[model samples]
Target: TLSEIATMAGVTPSTVSRALNPAASHLLSKKTSERILALCDHVGYRPSLLARGTATGFTYKVAMILHDMEKDLNAHDWNRITCATSAFLQESGYSLVLLRTSEKGTSMDMQVSHFLMSGIADAYITSPSMLKNNTLEMLNSLKSPLFVICEHGVPFPVSDGVLRSDADAFKQVWSRIPKEMHGKICFLSTINDNTQRLLTNIKRAAWDLGIDANNAISTLSLARTSKVPAMEYAEAYHQTKKMIKSFNQFDFVWCISDFFALGVKDALTECGRCPGKDVFILGYGDLETFPGVSEKPVLSTISANTHEIARNMCSVIMKKLDGEHTDIVTVKSSFISRSTF
Candidate 1:
């Protein structure tokens, strides 16, 4: 096949081989390499994995480890990240293998250990949740590169990963709030590490802006006991309705997510309060649609730019695969202002 491609490109077989090899391709002239590559493409001549392995000693496979795969699969941010990462890895001539920590009766530790021993992938990209206690230390012991995608404020010791910038997003939102609503803003968030970080950022920003942080920021944490598929919306609705019944001092409410914001709007309507008129509502994550909210007000929220995060993540992994060190990367979020604020 090499000989055939070389003859068609008017180059020797050895020259074609060198041009096609990833490591040695740089040694050949640009014109010759491009000609050989074009010829190979025209012929649909994908090199055999066995041959490539013999030459490079790499599996060319990257594994993405996800926790709570079923729930995350439907999540907009996770879906976008997975799709973008897969596309980028494919473009870089690598295949992606997805491993769910919750699969089978196997624990996260067992799954990771098995994969490490089996050599199923050359490198790994995982969520911060998967790297807890001994798991992170175990991964660090391996020769293979490991990358983590961490929540906005969760501290990750490793230097090769991406951290979402929820703090920046919160600051942007706080800075843009009307002066009239400065001391009358309420925050509704789920009791999670990421949301806690966001709330902390909001409080810090308020303090920095000379606003009374304690009086300006009122927070309600929705419990995670509910198992409903739409638990976020349901919890927000119930909690907000309760809050409205007892306390109605706040003029603006910021939710941790758009889905929760929609529920907050519904609760406000039930309490005889108009969403945009009586109280402006804000949320994070620019979801496309919210169910049961027909006349949806344009929501003021933060867009995480999952695509950019995925691209950066893939770039870091690629650098690691090439035996290069990568610094920790943080992807900043942008605020989208609309009628809700």
Candidate 2:
């Protein structure tokens, strides 16, 4: 069918092939590409992915391995990141294959290995949480393109992935808070590796600014408290309400997420405290709202900048496919000032 289309367009089969692939379509003149595409539309010819893969040795699909979709499917940050990644890949003539490493009916390693051996994807985008001890070894042995989305302390080669520089982000955001409000800082956190690392960085940033962590810094881990449950927003709301009296001790409240920040703001408002005037509030992942129809987010936060991450991921992946050398990319987060601050 492609050969017939090429014949009608007065071009070679190879030219037709390049024109059909959006990523490589620029190789042809606009006039030539338009003619080929119009001819295909006239004939109602749709290219088969299997046929194209067999011929080009590329499946034009990227496997995105995720962990525990059952719970994380509700996360606003991950949803944004995944949607952005898919949109970027789609523009580059690639499809995304979502694979869960947990809550599936098979072992995570086995499922990943099967896909790798089957040539089901041209490349893979994965994070550290999706990998295990054995899975990392298998993934590293892959000759095809593999891009990792991780923070610090991953075992992969530096050139193969991107890192989120949250520590640097903390430093940037900390300096922007009102100097007077820096006297009593309280970190509202959850028990996780990322939260631990972030708290360490936050404390270091304060210390660098001539604020003593021992005297000014205090932490309340939501995960360790009995009042906290599965839901992040609800846990934050109830916990802040239960400890509303204690909140008077803090001059600044740094929340782990926008949801928590909003919850804390609401609780403070209900308890007759001015959030911005009394206690400056800051949150992470500058999300405007929840995943579905929900309360609008108005808290000042450090934006994870999913759009930039997606652009960088797609760029590096394309470069790798074109046999170009790529090094570790560090994406920086920025602060978003809002009424809460």
Candidate 3:
């Protein structure tokens, strides 16, 4: 088919090959390349990814390893991050492959080793939650570059790293609180691995403003309780209502997620406190645009800017591919104003 297309376009197989490869296509003239491409299209010729990879020693696929593979993929933040990553990579002639740390309770190290040895991906990307000792060993052994994305801006030893600083986001929301309400700030989140880090960041933000966090910040973790990712909304609703029944002693409330914020808002209202007037509420991970969520959300929140993070990740990968070194990148979160605050 290559020779046939070359012949039809009055060119040699070498020229046709150059035209087919995106990186090498620039070597040919615009007119010649267009002619060859148009002829190939006319004859319904499609290049095989496997064949191209075998010949060039590159699969053009990036593997994104996940820590909690059991979590629902339909969750808004997960969906946004993955979709944005995939779309960005696709623009640069690459594809994304999702690999869970464990599958059916199998060893994560073994799974990671298998994928590494198979040589199916050109590069690797992962978060701190998914990084393991042996897994890091395998990734280090490979010549392919590894990129790390820190979801909560945690420090890690990596040449290429991207940090989406939840601290900055929390700080932005904190500054919006009225000065009088500084000492009455209440934060509510479900128990999870990153809860402490998030809490620390929130307090650190207040401390940076010369506020004594010990006296100003109060935290509740629903008392050692955890909910599945999908059922967080209902869990937050019931738990928050119970808490409100006992005590409501805060001028400003900040939640780890929009679901929790919504729960707190409803609980406050049902208990005779107005969300905007009697108390102020803020949340993270803007959920107004999420599927099955209300378009007209009343809660003020912070956006993680998943699309921007995806672009930066791809930019780092591309730089590595071009034999350039990049420093750690920190993307700041932005605040979205709404009726609640």
The best candidate by TM-score is 2
For residues 1-341, write the lDDT of model 3, one tens digit per residue. Answer: 89998888888999998887766789999998988888888888967988987887888999877666545255567678778989989877889998766533368757776787787588888744466323455566455778886756355757786778877666777677767876678788766535777778888887887777778878777743555545666777778788874337788887888877887788788888998897888888888767557868788998888788889988889888877878778777888889998
> How many residue pairs in model 1 have overlapping backbones?
0
Candidate with the larger TM-score of 1 and 3: 3
Question: Residue by residue across 112-153, what tens digits does model 2's lDDT show?
Answer: 677777876878887544553234555654557788876654
In model 3, the Cα lDDT at residue 67 comes to 63
Give the poorly placed runs of model 1, Cα more than 4 Å off: 11-44, 102-111, 132-134, 191-194, 223-229, 270-272, 289-297
**Predicted candidate 1 versus true structure: per-residue lDDT over 1-341, tens digit per residue:** 98888888887988988887665788898988998898899899967977876787788888877666666666767777888888888777787888766533457757766777677788888754455432455455355777877776577767778887766677777787777786678787766534666777778877777767787778767766553335778877887787775337888888878878878888888988877787888887777433344466477778888888999998998888887878888898888877677
Clashes of each: 0, 0, 0
Sort the predicted structures by TM-score, highest score first.
Answer: 2, 3, 1
Worst 10 residues of 1 by lDDT: 288-297
| TM-score on alpha carbons, each prediction | 0.82, 0.87, 0.86
Native-vs-model 1 lDDT?
A: 0.75
Candidate 3 pairs with clashing backbones:
none
Model 1 TM-score, 2 decimals: 0.82
